[model samples]
Target: MSDYLSNPLELFSVAGKVAVVTGASGAFGEVAAEVLAAAGAKLVLAAGKKAELAAIAEKCRARGAEVAEVNVRPTSEAVCDELVRTAVATFGRVDILVVASGKNDVAKIVDMAPERFLDVMDANVTQSWLVARAFTKQLLAQGGGGKIVLMSSARGLLGHPAGYTAYCASKSAVDGITKALGCELGTQGITVNAIAPTVFRSPLTAWMFEENDNATAVRKGFLGRVPVGRLGEPQDLAGPLLFLASAASDFYTGHVLYADGGYTAG
Candidate 1:
């Protein structure tokens, strides 16, 4: 108990820990890598974009983090297993995993092809499971607690007017996986949780942050529902990512921490 009271900040320290972040080139993934790197964790960054992955790797290296870049995506069991193996090979073990690899294909259900919906599910749901499975296996073999942070969205819980059937369905599945795996791994000292964010500052949504008419109109409507009265910034995710990735969130599992600025509360 004294350990909890003394140096509370120490609970958030991930220094010297090994972290594997998929989709390291994506918005949330980039922030995850940056946070882990700045906090002193060795990083294994995986993404399909070679150049972007290398850029992120260099950025982490600039922060004095030992980084291993893997030009791959968690599209298959073998690839996901390779991510875990690479982490273990480079850092001897993985203490944290951030499944940030996912995509959203917006189209009305009637207009969307079956293949498109399946693609979203494969990216957002199946890949999350694959990476978690691989990471859990490694954690069990190593005999220690680990953290798995899966990316979800407000869309998981709320519906959007603009063609989000595929995205919504996929994220809901991710939420389910988080809960199931969290319970499954609780006894093993491993915790599985997810960060479900609303619209935040990212390349895909950058236009909404602009000063144009369309941007202003969209922002106005979106902000009407957000009690915080603003969209999320990348910095908004830094704290949650750090919390879930560190000892601070040890008691939290099978949970979805929404970083949506109260967008879903109403």
Candidate 2:
């Protein structure tokens, strides 16, 4: 091995790499963009809103990283293709893709509308597949390997009786997609993985963590199940994300790295 490769820490360097992060406006997406930029990756941030994506781009730029912003919804193949094109046009090539855009609707199966369930599936599963497919095509064209990180939820691995039917089902599909794509793309030098996190303090879940009696009761119940005795933080995902995005995880693919504070360990 070369001198640079001889150092263990050097394996985690993403310096000079180009990355495209979808759902850049969301909480986890914001953290992904910031962390990747800090790790020296040039970034292209895409999300549903232009203003939000622009804001994230500005933050990333301040970190001394090159950043491009694209307003896009990854549900359409055309939009997904355009996102990859924009990244390649801006940064020459993409080395990483983080699909962090997803939606969850809290409704019991008995009361869930078909449209609502489909919406969650489209947002979480279908959109993720489209984006990954487009990004993979670009990676194949360039004849270089890349990393794809899909955001899943701990609910995918465990059942929840609290009206998480659609969300859980959608995330479960994401996990399957991650494994399937990993198997198909391994020979092409692309690694596919998912980060499944437990309840985190994101805008979507802010109500659940609010300083209210109901929220406190909910938190207490959740804490009892989590071995770590706390909820996941945005920063908690940074290290695992960076590891999977870097050369250190070259031999690892189709794996679900649970950042659930040992909630799934039992």
Would you list the C-alpha lDDT of every candidate in the order shown? 0.95, 0.92
- List model 2 lDDT by residue over 1-266, tens digit each: 55764688999999999999999999899999999999999999989888888998999999999988888889799999989989888888999999999888998889999999999999999999999999999999999599999999888888888899899999999999999999999999999999999878788788877899999998998899899898888898999999999989999999999999999997
lDDT of 1 by residue, 79-98 (tens): 98988998998889999999
Q: Tell me the number of clashing residue pairs for each predicted model.
A: 0, 0
TM-score of each: 0.99, 0.96
* Candidate 2 local Cα displacement, residue 23, angstroms: 0.3
lDDT of 2 at 24: 93
User: TM-score winner among the candidates?
Assistant: 1
lDDT of 2: 0.92
RMSD of 1: 0.7
Error of 1 at 165 (Å): 0.5
